[model samples]
Target: MYADLWSFALSTYARPGCEAACLRLQAQGADVCLLLCGAWLEQRAVTVTAERIQALKHIARPWQTDVIEPLRRVRTQWRAMAQQDEDLAGLRERVKALELDAERQLLGRLEALAQTWPIGNAIDQLHWLEGLAAEDAANLDHDALQQLRVVVTNA
Candidate 1:
């Protein structure tokens, strides 16, 4: 296991099909950073609880809404225009990097909150993913979730 959430996320995201799966989940209204953190917690055998889920969400939601989403919106808004303009494309790339950095910061915050929590208490680690997923769980893509779980476990 990677000792930290960010390291685990970086490695897990690099695994084949992981990026696509995460993107699909994100499109379905799931918070990708939270899901990645969920994967990290699961890999570490951390027990899931309602309180713990709320704690992580508390740390993630604001930063995501205030910081990451705006960066993402700007980068996405520029996609088509950037395709035609080299300068816009370069600016878009920079925005993309900022978005990534924002996510990293969010992950760091999440780690700071959960790092002290005990691990190896859950018999079933899947709870972290399920708990952190969208409120309308029925809409979530099970295949993508499963792929993420498989990759995290394998890693």
Candidate 2:
């Protein structure tokens, strides 16, 4: 189990079905950074409380809205044009990289915020996820979320 957020994100995202699950959740307005943070916390057997979940989201929301989402929007918006324009494709690739960097920075911030939070005996694997994505969780693609939870818990 990886304790480092970035490393855990990289490895867990590379797992089969994990990327698709993440993208699905992302499209549903879930914060991927928080999802990865959830995975890391689960790896360490942290007990999730509603207050702690809100604290994590509070840290992630601003950066995601102000930084990562814009880069992602530009990158995604350029997809069709990028198919026909080499210059735009290059620019889109760079934007994609920037988006990744933005997420990395967000993860760093999340790690810092929870660095001193105590670990607990019980593992609330889905609580973190639900807290972050509660609205969509009600109508989520259950299989995909289950897949993500499996990856999150290393199950």
Candidate 3:
């Protein structure tokens, strides 16, 4: 049931209509949570308090592992390679290739992560992925500068 709820939320979030679509999806997700919570409370024969509801929301927010470690390692390796290369012409192409490949991997990983996040704010999750992408891009820019310097000296 949770899986179905999450899938619906994600699809609804992705659909392009207007502001109304987003509102509708959020309402549906929250309603499902309420229904599940109600059933759980009824089954347990316990009164649901505000704190209990908050706890349910917390559980629903599902945590996703930050995917920065692999990206960090890739960036560090690229930085080292850029610093060590003497010929810019030969290494420039390779450097560009590395950045391109890293970007591709980053997007794929981020999208995969989004799919796993709980059914609250997939939009916020997407924004967080964008943050990781932006930060990674900056690291690439710095690495490229180091690479260019090595190239200029050898040329």
Candidate 4:
């Protein structure tokens, strides 16, 4: 659930010309998926005691590196873009078109980078695509494009 929602929010928030909007949302305290995931882990611990809490924290520490750090990286990029003076309209338009042509697949390039994902976790595999440059993902192969179909339902 964190993976899916985070993946969806990541791409939407990173729209080329929407940096200001993304920052606004973040400032309002959204995109705190890590916090929610952490809470979930804590609650699911064997007991609601100090030992269980410590154990949950230990289990979740490594995940913070893999999952939380990616989201933080995305937030960093969004802040940088939000502060830039560059005009991103044209680039955004180009990305939309390319994404459309590729059948609205947003995760294509990232999937290619990872080569493949575990069985039954296809949608979550898109988690690797957060904060990426759309231009960098512009060139995708067939399998990558197929994986991207996970982003846009109608695609």
Candidate 5:
């Protein structure tokens, strides 16, 4: 397991099928950064609690909504136009970079918040993924969620 959340996220995301699974979850309204953090916490055997989940959401929601989402919207909006124009493509790429940096910052904040939480204390450590997932958990893609779980456990 990685010593840091960001490293863990990077490695986990690079696993085969993980990226697509993450994207699928994201499209379903789940916060990928939060899910990744939850995966890291799960790997470390951190106990999932309402307060902890709320705290993670408190930090993640605003950053994702105010910082990351706008950058993504801009980048996505420019995708087609950028494909037709080199200048727009350059600007879009920059926006994409900024979006990624913003996500990294959010991950850092999440790690700082969760780093003090003890690990290996949970009787059941499998809640992180579902707990950190979108509020509409019943509607989420179970297959994608399972894929992520398999990748994390196998790692």
Candidate 6:
């Protein structure tokens, strides 16, 4: 288990298939911060509840929408042109870093919010994932979710 949320998120996201699962869930309007947090809690065998899911969502949505998404939008908007333009490419790289920083900040806030929550004696694994993505859960890839579960659990 990670000592901090940022480390956990970084390691988990880097795991094979986790990125695809995140992106797929993102397309369905799920917040990656929440997903990462969910995974962190799952790893620690935290008991997930509807109230907890909402709390995480409430804490993450504002920063993700206001800070992270704009940086991501601009970086993505310049993707094609950045490949051809040296200056834009450099700026785009900076934006990418900024986006990552913004996400780290969000994770820090999340860590602060629930750092005191007790770990469960029995892990209700994937309950957070299902709650966070309940509206679009059916649309996501089962295999990718399974891969994430395997990686997270084994971590």
Candidate topping TM-score = 5
TM-score of each: 0.96, 0.91, 0.24, 0.26, 0.98, 0.91
Residue-level error in angstroms, candidate 4, position 33: 5.6
Clashing pairs for predicted structure model 3, backbone only: none
Pitting candidate 1 against candidate 5, the one with the higher TM-score is: 5
Residue-wise C-alpha lDDT for candidate 5, range 1-155, written one tens digit per residue: 79999899999999998999999999999999999999999999999999999999999999999999999999998999999999999999899999999999999999999999998788898999999999899999989999999999999
Model 5, stretches more than 4 Å misplaced?
Answer: none
Q: Report clashes for each candidate as comma-separated counts.
A: 0, 0, 0, 0, 0, 0
Residue 57, candidate 3: C-alpha displacement in angstroms: 22
User: How would you encode candidate 4's per-residue C-alpha lDDT over 119-147 as one tens digit per residue?
Assistant: 34333333222212122233423233322
Q: Candidate 1, residue 49: CA error in Å?
A: 0.4
Best by lDDT: 5
Query: All candidates' lDDT scores?
Result: 0.92, 0.80, 0.34, 0.34, 0.94, 0.81
Q: For residues 87-117, what per-residue lDDT tens digits would candidate 3 score against the true structure?
A: 6434655655664454344333333433343
Single out the weakest 10-residue window by summed lDDT for candidate 4. 127-136
Candidate 6: global Cα-lDDT? 0.81
lDDT of 5 at 52: 98
| Model 6 regions lying over 4 Å from their true place | 123-125
Which ranges in model 3 have alpha carbons more than 4 Å from their true place? 1-87, 118-155
Per-residue lDDT of candidate 1, residues 1-155 (tens digit): 88888888899999998999999999998999999999999988888889999999999988988999999999999999999999999999999999999999999999999899988888877889988977788999989999999888887
lDDT score for candidate 1 against the true structure? 0.92
Task: Estimate, for each residue in 59-108, the C-alpha lDDT of model 2 and write its tens digit.
Answer: 88889889998888899899999999999999999999999999889998
